[model samples]
Target: MFKILFQLLAISAAFVLTAPVNNSTTGISKLNSQQYNVVPFGHVDLDDYLSNSTTFANHTYLSAPGSQNGLERRGSVHACQGSFTKKLCITGSNAANLVGALCHSISVALEIQSGNHNCADTGVHSVSDQTQGTVYYKYKTTGKGCTTTAEPGTIEGALHKFIKEKNQDKICDFVCIRLTHGGNWSGYVGLGTSQDAVKYSRCDHEIGSWSACVNGDKGDR
Candidate 1:
């Protein structure tokens, strides 16, 4: 009886371990493999982030289609880029730590382009062909409620700084911006600059049309 029971347990364990992983049970396996692999956004290195698409809905602002630096994406729809990889992508912030460096670069770009000096509210801007008409604004720091003070200089400089600083450490394959719905609404405020890299690393769904992509007074989504 002992021998028979031991054999049965072994067989059960082996069966559980060898079973094929499917998307329905484990969210990790449901990634849209083809789109993430074939599309070219900022760099091919981003493929590592794309591989885990199951979690796309958690961090980013939007996932559009198109190529960056002359490489074309393979998708036709306007869905989030990598919602399937939430569990894996949380391992890294992708490019959150380089904000300081990018801020400095933006200061310089403002001087060169607009001939201004102060780096107060000099917000940055970023856009990929992925989102056909949308352009992203990367702000240095916002006012009391994620609002900008004034135009520091050229928006491009601010954005250039952000990209440069971000790329220095980890290329930004995914970005998350926050929004503040005031008046006692309960929701996540924002992730900190020094929090665990993957804790709150999922993209959001606050996308808008290209014509309405400019920053009004909203925080990161």
Candidate 2:
């Protein structure tokens, strides 16, 4: 009887040790779900854009095209900033890679805005084709409220200082600038591969132009 009882207890201990842990409590869930891989841009606080009174209904998840392959799964997070009335989207093949890419991109944007014109210029004109990867600014407000001098050289110096101070990589593949009617501004800087960067840059430029025109602001070429 004693031997049998001891065996049963040992089996129970093995089961307890081998059972899967509850990730909900540990906060380290497996990254198997498609939704888990998609996230908001790092610099922007998406929650701040959402309303607490509402049920947070302005977000969606969509599968990325060409992610049919099992190993290369891709997903995107589409969200709207209710307060600003702006839409933001982010996509990635993997969550970790996407976060890293966003960090690098936002860092570049901040560096450029800090008066680093040279770095911003290089990123704006890095692609081989002039038509491709062209970076430009768009004014959001009308009537030319600000007529600052075009200090490209001074801006370049500031950008260089930003890179040195921030320890950022010199190479950039994509850049975007957004100006709001309230004088608030934002940018997206991406360090994707040459091909991906050019694509994103072109798209951002077009979108920026459209937004500026719609808001009665001049588009910077």
Error of model 2, residue 211, in angstroms = 13
- The per-prediction CA RMSD against the true structure, in angstroms, equals 22.2, 23.0
TM per prediction: 0.20, 0.25
Model 2 lDDT tens row, 1-221: 99999997875442221122222324333333332122111111111221112221222222222122221111111111111111221222222232332333333334444443231322322211121221211111112322213232222222222222221222232222222111233233322223233322332222321111100000110
Model 1 CA RMSD to the hidden true structure, in angstroms: 22.2
Query: For model 1, how does the per-residue alpha-carbon lDDT over 76-187 read when each residue is reduced to its tens digit?
Result: 1111222212221211233332332333333333333323322243322432222122122232222243332223222222233223322232223333322222221111
User: Lowest-scoring 10 consecutive residues by lDDT in candidate 2?
Assistant: 212-221
Model 2 misplacement above 4 A? 1-95, 108-112, 115-120, 124-181, 184-205, 208-221
Residue pairs with clashing backbones, model 2: 105-189, 116-159, 117-155, 117-156, 118-156
